[model samples]
Target: MQEIFSAILGDQLGPFGPLILMGTLGAVLILFTLPVLLKKKQDPLDRLRDQIKTSKDVANGKAPARLRYDNQKGARLEKYSAFLEPQDEEEYSAAQLKMIQAGYRSKNAVRMFHFAQFAMGLGALALGLIYALLKSAQQDMSPKSLVLTVLLPGVIGYMAPKYWVTRRIEARKEEIVNGFPDSLDLMLVCVEAGQSLDQAIIRVAVEIRAGFPALADEYEIVSHEIKAGKDKSVVLKDMAERCGVPDVASFVTVLIQSQQFGTSIADALRIYAAEMRDKRVMRAEEAANKLPTKMTLATMMLTVPPLLIILIGPSVYDIYTLLNETNF
Candidate 1:
């Protein structure tokens, strides 16, 4: 039976084959989301009927209701989330902020994140089991190889969520850095039009919501924080920190200084706006300068080798044929 099992599962497919198989299993587990999403999505007609029902209730002086969610699913998620919750206060806050930076900020976002982390760890372990079994069959089925193969992927699976979240934070920070100059320009225009800084932020958020939503969301949050009795300078500083943009930090600094010294905000904003525009232009020129060097490397990798082969192969073949005809 062991021989039969080994023969069927252990065909040699090179060093990368087991790894590819494990990756395929991980990908298959990810597809579980498709069924959940498809199941939860209501038909257009069903949604329309729900909307009509809510409208009629509002017309009849009754409160309109929100869509019903599955309590059992929520409970299960919360349970799994608690299983993976961070123990340290700082770690918990950092995790929450990372999720927010990744554009998840609902009340349940933290819970959902922890749940996903748990799911991925289990999925990785299962994939590692199959990979380990396959590898053991193909080669020496030792305890050490089994332990090494299973343990490595299991550890990677446990840390994958953190890695993905870190990537999202960096990507979000880059967007803020790239789009912030325009957002600053828009807010400057609003400030010059005699709007208060708070009002300017609100207006800018509306204006740039489609083009620069990440920055707009920060602005929107600032507006809400101010309305909710937070100090404007503190909120602005917090936003800059959360965005992780040096330009935004400088912009916030100027705004805070202007407010403190009773300076003309319009003047302050105008000067900063010009500086941001110049910085953006310089960044573009720098990227353009690097393009040629990058393309040179790409040409060497993708073009030069092919050309060399094409130019040399026919001559080499001709020389061989000539030598053969001369009976050399």
Candidate 2:
């Protein structure tokens, strides 16, 4: 038993063993502590509840009307509120701005994305370091080579998250765009069925919830804005701006103008939906036309080099054999 314990201790405390133990402990500590720290810092509901309490106190003349929360999250909330503030200098409450900003937006998910990026970068750095250490310990490596090996992986890791984020954003935008015409068609049907514009938006939002959650989410934001007493035009415009899609923006502008001019909303929506469908058809045809070009490029990349190698290799070997025979 004594010998066994001594062997175990010797293995653990061998050369560079302490370093391994320290690294493991540090990693475990970070994993255990980071969530606790982030959770403590990120409880928005607590801040919101505090804000409500402060508002009640101020309204009852029990406390001075001054800002209470002073964290980064609070500051971000304030900035978002300022951005959402109506330009007419009306007595618009900050609550409305907060609601608008929070409506259908995943604050934690955005933060988690950034966190994921950081973790990826750190992982890459660790991988690079491990590679460098292993190479240096196992083989005679120069300092420059070690540095290059270590730094290259870290750099790749840093850029990977940015690339992933960009791809996700593009994919989400495409999904929203693809779902727009259908949502518009549903709205048109609802309007023709005698629902008001707001009701139509709500009905369409509900209808699209299963198939296109992203579009449904945007419409839900519009519904929230309307419920918050924002004007229909403003809500629609905000939806367009938030979506950042040209077709949706144009549709919103057209709807606003039609409403202002007493034009038929259903007719305008139907026309827009028809136009979008036509555009989608054109895009499909364009993609189909490009398929041959894409295929040609792919074939050149994947097939041509191998074909050249196979065709040239036997001839080159034959020529070499003939030249050797002549020399003999």
- List candidate 1 stretches off by more than 4 Å: 1-83, 130-156, 310-328
Residue pairs in candidate 1 whose N, alpha carbon or C atoms collide under 3 angstroms: none
lDDT of 2 at 41: 48
lDDT of all the models against the reference? 0.79, 0.72
TM-score of candidate 1 versus the correct structure, residues matched by position: 0.68
Residue 239 in model 2: lDDT: 81
lDDT of 1 at 141: 56
Across 1-328, the per-residue lDDT of candidate 2 in tens digits comes to 4455446555433344344445646866886776555443437999999999998998898986555645575344443332223434443433233333333244333334345556677788678767655654555666576667767887887788567655655665687888988888888889889999889989998998998887888888889889999999999888876666788889989999998999888889889999999998998999999999889989999999999989998999999999999999
| Local accuracy of candidate 1 as per-residue lDDT tens digits, 1-328 | 5445346555563344455455657757766764454344458999999899888888998965655875565565653443457778899888777788887776566677777776787678778877765675567655566666777787888788878888888888888888888887888888878899899999999988887788889999999999999998999899877787789899889989999999998999889989989998999999999999989989899998899889998999999999999995
lDDT of 1 at 91: 90
Give the true-structure RMSD of model 1.
Answer: 11.8
Number of the top candidate by lDDT?
Answer: 1
Score every model by TM-score: 0.68, 0.64
Query: Who wins the TM-score comparison?
Result: 1
